[model samples]
Target: MRLSRSFLPTLKENPAEAQITSHRLMLRAGLIRQTAAGIYAWLPAGLRVLRNIADIVREEQDAVGAQELLMPTLQSAELWKRSGRYDAYGPEMLRIRDRHERDMLYGPTNEEMITDLFGQIIKSYKELPQVLYHIQWKFRDEVRPRFGVMRGREFYMKDAYSFDLDHDSSVDTYRRMMLAYLRTFQRLGVRAIPMRADTGPIGGELSHEFLILAPTGESGVFFDSALEEQDWLGEDVDIHDRGSLEKFFTGMTSFYAATDEMHDAEAWAKVPAERQREGRGIEVGHIFNFGRKYTESMDITVSGPDGAPLYPEMGSYGIGVSRLVAAIIEASHDEGGIIWPETVAPFRAVIINLKSGDSTCDALCEKLYAAAPEHFLYDDRAERAGAKFADADLMGHPWQLIVGPRGAKEGKVEIKNRRTGERTEATPEDALALVMKTQG
Candidate 1:
């Protein structure tokens, strides 16, 4: 991906409309562009990051045995009517009418539709447990859609619905989702703590919101530092084993964690003084255990083992896939620009040709880029060295492979880690080896 051939439209100055750090950086770095109020078009680089995040999400969901299936962006209004929330849901629901005048909607969430669909497919306890998920675009008519993708009216989301025949099994499904969310965030290269939260329009008594710490977050957060020490990917819990999931859930929830709306001074005091952590946090994902709310309201039923009709318990889990792009920037950027976690970085490293037209520098850069053209963005534009350095830092590739004439002439390249600002001069082969190892 050569810069001369790329569509990167980076800005030298911040846009006035961007109020938050993520919003400003996203615009200045040319990752996204506003097409309408609270709506955006993701550019090539932005889409790359979006896809990377979704892939990690998909992998974790698959690991937990959740089946992947895409659902429609447009849903029937009748689905919501059956659940008695069509009108009660208020203006945020983007109500519309087809040419024939049928009531329709761009889905804000998929509970009603998923319930109706699930009821039709599984008719007996023999199909007791099913967890289905989809990643799709959704729209909500936000009265004031602000803060870029962080609070966009239209955005990409990953929503999963789980159904179980019994309360005990349904709770276990909820625990499994909790485990999945923790591992998902951990792999995305951020510390996201699960805090008990309001179910809101989703309507669930049991819910948890995962918030990643950031100074620009909308909510105040308090938790025990111990939550920061665990490595979820390294966790030993077996998703298929009920006792294993139960133990994992208990161990995780044992640490006190809460958003300001649910904060308890009594519980906060109980945490060791050294363990108390207070900061602002941005929500990236949420999970709910609503039991029979949707199933009962939609009158979805299956035969029980005793041969009587039964309503399957249901839960919903959601991650703001697009919003995460912004949330991650909020949590991980510095004065220069975004410092991406390697797992979600659009490109693992960028090849900077300090002297673009210079024979030696161009040759060295081409050599580095050719090794993994798909994973590296090559700055081959005829530009000044200072401008090249600024753009590379602003774009925030995890590493910068510098090819100046001085380094290239000696058959050496300079590699700089964006996060640590560490630079080392090495043979081109050695530099590639180090980066490839880090990437692995």
Candidate 2:
């Protein structure tokens, strides 16, 4: 993608309304624009980043046997009424009325609707263990929505529902999701610690919130430093094996971690002072073992082996697909701008034409552009070198390939690491090879 041809509307000054780093940078970098109080229109650059994140999430979900199925944004209020949660859900639920005067709503979550769907078709235990997920927009109508997408009233989320015939199997499903969540976040270059959390309106004794520590985060968290050192990608996870999943669970849960809602002073005090780390955290993923909460309420029953009606045990896992962009920026950005992880960056490397319109520099950029992947954004616009450099830094691709008359004359291109700020000069072919190796 050529910058001159792209719709990247970067700003020179921070927007006053943006209170957080992610919010401010997202606006300044032209990734998103606020259409309303908490609703945003994802611009081209931002949409690319969102797609990258969503693809990673889908890959991880598929790897764990979860099937994708999108549910409607607008739902019949009758579904919530069936579960006796119509009034209980409070103002966060965006209630509405259709022309026929029927009660309707933009779904904040899909428990009631999914339970209704499961009850309608899944009658036998043959389909006992199934995981259904969707990546879709959700509306919560938050009273004081702020902090950009972090607490947006309208945002994208990846929500999955798991159904099992028995309690034992349901717990296994929960564990599988936990492992998958850890793997997903790890692959995105973020280390999220799973901490015991209050289930809130979701109603579950067993719940975990995957938190990424950041100063501007919403949740206060305390945990063992060991969590930072553990890597989920290092292990071979077998989701079908209950025993193996249990071991993985134990290994991860051995470290003490808790959100403020579930914090226990006595348990925290027992940890050695050196191992304790208390800080603010951003919640990126949440999983709950809600048992029969939804199934029982909605009468989603399956026939047992003994021919008795049984309410399927259930759980739900959620990842804030849109909020992750803010969380990532909060954790990774420096003074310049966002330092995007290669996995979620809109472009793997941005080729900045330092001396655009100059014959040698323009020719070198053309060569690099031809060799680069579709994801690479070539800045061939007629902008000053400093402006191009600043824009490249603000956009935060993992690598920056710069071309200039001097470097082109020497048959060399400069490749700079966005995260480490290390600059190296190499032949164009060598630069391409280095970028491919690093991006992969």
Candidate 3:
């Protein structure tokens, strides 16, 4: 995409309302704009990153045999009433009314609706093990929506539901999701520790919240320091292998990890002094093994092998997709701006025309754009070199290729890695080759 044609409203100064690094950088980079309190309109650049993150999430979900389907943002309140949570959900539920006075709501979560949908179609144990997921917008009426998208009242999320006929099989499904979640966050370049957490309004005895440690985070967490060194991406995970999945789950949970609500002083004291890590963390994803909570309430029953009616065991997994955008910034950015993981960067690399109108520099940039295999944001706008440099850094592409008269005359361009601040002069072909390899 050409900068001259992009809808990038780069800001000169930080927005006062944005107190967090992610919020400030997001505003300065023109990735998003506040449409209302806690609601945002994702601009072109931000949308690209959002789509990239969604794609990665979809791929990981698919890897675990979870089928994809989109659910509606608005749901009838009758479904929640059936699950007995309509009244229990409290003010966070954005209750609405249609013109005919029927109770409606912008969905905060989809447990009730999904249960109703599953109950109508599934009747036998043959379809017992199934996972269905959707990526969509959700709204919660947060009385105090703050911290930009981190704690937004409205956000995007990927929620998956798993149904199984027996407790043993349900545990298998939960383990698969736990492994998938670990891989998902690892690929996004965030170290998320799975901490036992309160089920809250979701209501489940077995729950885990995958948290990424950041000083500006809202949740206080305690864990073993070994989690920081353990590598989740070291091996390929086979989600269908029950034993392997179980082993991974057991291994990961063997460490001492819990949020403040679940913390035990006795357990904390048991850990060797050097292994303890207490810090603030952001909850990026959560998973729950609710067993038959919704299924029993909503009459989602399947026929057992013995021909008896039985409620299907169930689990729900959620990843706060929009909140991850903020979480990533909080964990990775430096003083300059965001340093995006290559997997989620809006663009792989940028082509900066240092001398915008200069014939040689312009020709070099245009040639690079025309020849490159991947999309490169060609900065052909009438902006100063310093401004272009700053914008490139704030935009957080993996690489920046700078073209100037001096470099063009010497048949070289300045190639920079955004994350490491590494710059080197290279021939045009060499620059493209480096980018191609890194992108691959």
Candidate 4:
């Protein structure tokens, strides 16, 4: 994408309202703009990054046998009432009334609605195990919505619901989801530790919140340092194998990890002094095994093997798709700007035309841009070299290819790694080859 044609409204100075690094960097980098207190309008650059993150999330969910289906942002109040939560859910629920005086609401979560839908189509044990997920916008009336998307009132989320016939099957489904979450966070370039957490309004006896450690995080976490060394993606665990899933889950949970609410002094003392890890962490995802909470309340039932009526056990898994944009920034950014992970980066590399009008530089940049247009963002504007460099760094493309007149004339360009700040001088052909190799 050409900078001249792009709608990036980057600011030179930080906005006073942004209190965190991700919030301040997001504004200065022109990724998002606040339309209301906690609502934001994602711009072109921001939308690209958001879509990339969502795609990765979708792919990971699919890998775990979860099917994708979008749900509406607005839901009938009757659904919540059926689950006995309409009154229990407090002010955060955005209650409304239609012209007909019927109650309605912008859903904060979809447990009740999903249960109603599943009950409608599934009436027998034939569909005993199923996972359905949707990526959509959700709203919560936060009394104090701040820190940009981190605690936004309106944001995008991916919520998945799993239905099984009994407790054993439901536990298996929950274990599979835990594995999926670990892999998803690993691919997003963040080490998210799974810690036992309170279900809060979701009302589940079993729950886990995946947290990414950051100094600006809201909750205090205590975990074993060994949790950081586990390579979830590298582990060989077949999602469809029950024993494999159970073993993997047991292995992962063996580490001492818990949020402040669930912290146990006796357990903490058991860990080696050097292996004790404690810090502030931000929640990026959560999973819950609510069992028959909704099914029992809403009178949802399916036929059992013995032909008896049975309430299906259920579990819900959630990943903060929009909040991840800010979380990634918080976990990865430096003094310059966000250092995006390649998997979720808007573009793999950016090409800077140091001398826009210079025939040599223009020719070199155009050649590189055409080589992989989808993977590169071409800076063709007639801007100073310093400004171009600053903006490139701020956007945090994994690599920056510099084509100055002198280097272009010599048939050489400079390639700089955004994370390491390492520069290499090579011919345009050599640079392209290097960048393409990294793309793999």
Candidate 5:
């Protein structure tokens, strides 16, 4: 994408309303704009990042046997009423009335709706073990929606629902989701620790929140450092194998980790002081094993092996797709700007034309840009070198391929690593080769 042709609206000064690093940087970098108090219009650059994150999330979910489907943002209020939560869910629920005066709402979550859908279609135990997921926008009326997308009232979310006929099978689904979450976060270049958490309105006895540690996090967390060292994707556990999944689950839970609400002094004392780690963390994902909470309330049932009516045990897993954009920034930004993880960066590298009109610089920049037009952001704007460098750093492409008049004339260009701030001089072909190698 050419900077001159793009709609990026980067600002020189931070927005006063942005209190956190992610919020301030998001505004200054032109990733998003606030349309209303907690609602944002994701600009072109921001939308690219959001889609990248969602794609990774979708792939991980699909790998774990979860089938993707589209769910509507607006839902009939009758479903929540049947689940006995229409009234229980407080002001956060945006209650509305249609032309006929029928009640409706923008769904904050999809538990009751999904339960009803399953009850209608799944009548026998043969369809007992199914995982269904959707990536969609959700709305919650946060009294104080601040910190950009971190606590936004309107955001994109990926919510998955698992249905099983028995308690053991349901727990297995939960364990599988836990492993999936670990893999997803690892791929996103953040170390997210799974800590025991309150179920909140979800109403589950067993729940885990994947918290990415950041200084600006809202949750205070205590954990064992060993949790951060586990390579989930490297482990030889098959997602379809029950025993393998159980073993992996046990290994992960063996670590001492708890949110402030679930902290136990006795458990904390058991850990060696050197291995204990405490920090503020932002929640990126959550999974719940609520068993029959929704099924029982909504009378969702299927026939058991014995042909008896049974309420299917269920679990819900959620990853904040939009919030992750901000979370990733919070966890991995420096003074200059966001240092995006290559896996989710909008572009793998940015090509900066340091001397735009110079024949040599233009030729070199055009060559590099054409080599991988889709994977590179070509800064063809007629701007000063300083402004070009600042915008490239602020946008946080993983690499900066610099073409200056002198370097271009000498058939040499500079390749700078965004995260490490390391620069190396290379020919245009060598630089393209390096970027391709990183992509591979």
Candidate 6:
């Protein structure tokens, strides 16, 4: 993307309405714009980041054998009514009457709807176990929606539902999703700790929420650092193998991790003094094992091997796809701006032309960008070098290839590492090679 032609509207001052770092930075950096209270229109750069996150989520889910299928944003109210939750869901749910006076809702979650959909397809135990997922927009009418995408009324989410024939198998599915969540966060270049959580309206005894550490987080967290040190991406396990899953579950749960709501002093004291860690955490994902809750409520059942009707044990897993963009910023940003991870950055590196109109400088910037046009953002605008530098830092691409008349005359490109603030001079070819290698 060229700065001259791109829709990046960066700001010199923070927006007064943005109360959080991620919110303020997102608006000032031109990644998103507020279209309504608690709702936003993702600009080009923001949409690119969202897609990168969704892709990582999809890859991890697919690795665990979950098939993707999109469900609708508006769900029939009858689905909730059948489960006796229409009245219990409260004001957060946007209930409406369609043209025919039929009750409908902008879905906050898809438990009831997915249960009803799956029930319509499988009538027997032959279709016992299945994991289905979709990445879609969801809405909840929060009375006070704040913190930009972090607590937005409308946001993108990846929600998955698992169906199994028995309780033990359902628990295994839950474990599989736990691993998937770990791997997903790992690939996003963030460490998320899984802590036991209370399942709010979802209704499940077994639940866990993945929280990324950040000073601006909403929850106080206590845990051993060991939980964040695991290499989930390197783990080898068969999803269908019970023994392998049991070991994986035990390894993950062995660490003491909890939010303030679930903290235990006795357990905290058991850890070595040096190993104890305390911080604030923002929730990015959650998983629940609510066996038979939706299936029984919605009469979702299949014939058993013995020819008896049986309700399938179920679980639900969710990742805040859009919220993660903010959560990652919370966890990773510095005073300058958001230090994006290479894998999720809109562009891996940005080519800043310090002397835009100078013949040598322009030629060098063009040569550097042309080397990896798709992966580079060229600052082709005729702006002052100071403003270009400020915006480059504010946008936070991983690498900054700085070109100037002096260095360009000598065939040298100055490279700046965004994360480390390290600057070095090299030929255009060497600069491109370094950035591309680091991107990999």
Q: What local lDDT score does residue 182 receive in model 4, on the 0 to 100 scale?
A: 87
Query: What TM-score quantifies how close candidate 6 is to the native fold?
Result: 0.97
Can you tell me which runs of candidate 3 are displaced by over 4 Å? 233-237
Worst 10 residues of 2 by lDDT: 229-238
What are the lDDT scores of the predictions, listed in order?
Answer: 0.92, 0.91, 0.90, 0.92, 0.93, 0.92
Clashes of 4: 0
The TM-scores of all predictions, comma-separated, are 0.98, 0.98, 0.97, 0.98, 0.98, 0.97
Best by lDDT: 5
Least lDDT summed over 10 consecutive residues: which range in candidate 3?
231-240
Scored against the true structure, residue 403 in model 5 reaches a CA lDDT of 90
Comparing 5 with 6 on TM-score, the higher-scoring candidate is 5
Instruction: Write one digit per residue (lDDT tens) for candidate 1, span 1-440.
Output: 98899988999999999999999999998899999999999999999999999999999999988999988999999999999999999999998999999999999999998898898899999987999999999999999999999999999999999999888999999999998898888889988899999998889798999998999999999999988887554557888889998888888889999999999999899999998999999999999999999998999999999999999999999999999999999989889999999999989898998887788888888899999998999998888988888999899899999988888989998999999999999999998888778662
Q: RMSDs, each prediction? A: 1.1, 1.1, 1.3, 1.1, 1.0, 1.3
**Cα lDDT of model 6 by residue, 298-417, tens digit:** 988899999999999999999999999999999888888999999999999999998878988988888888888888999999999999888889988999999988899999999999
lDDT of 4 by residue, 1-440 (tens): 88888888778888999999999999999999999999999998889889988988999899989999988999999999988899999999999999999999999999988888998999899887989999999999999999999999999999999999889999999999998898888788888999998988887799999999999999899999988876655457988889998888888899999989899999999999999999999999999998889999999999989899999999999999999999999999898889998888888899999989888889999999999998899999988989999999999899999999889889999999999999999988889998888652
Tell me how far candidate 4 lies from the true structure as C-alpha RMSD in angstroms.
1.1
What is the C-alpha local distance difference test score of candidate 1? 0.92
Q: Which ten residues in a row have the lowest lDDT in candidate 1?
A: 230-239
Q: In model 2, what lDDT does residue 425 have?
A: 97
Per model, state how many residue pairs clash: 0, 0, 0, 0, 0, 0
Q: What does candidate 2's lDDT look like per residue over 351-403, in tens digits?
A: 98888788998888889888865868999888888999899999999999999
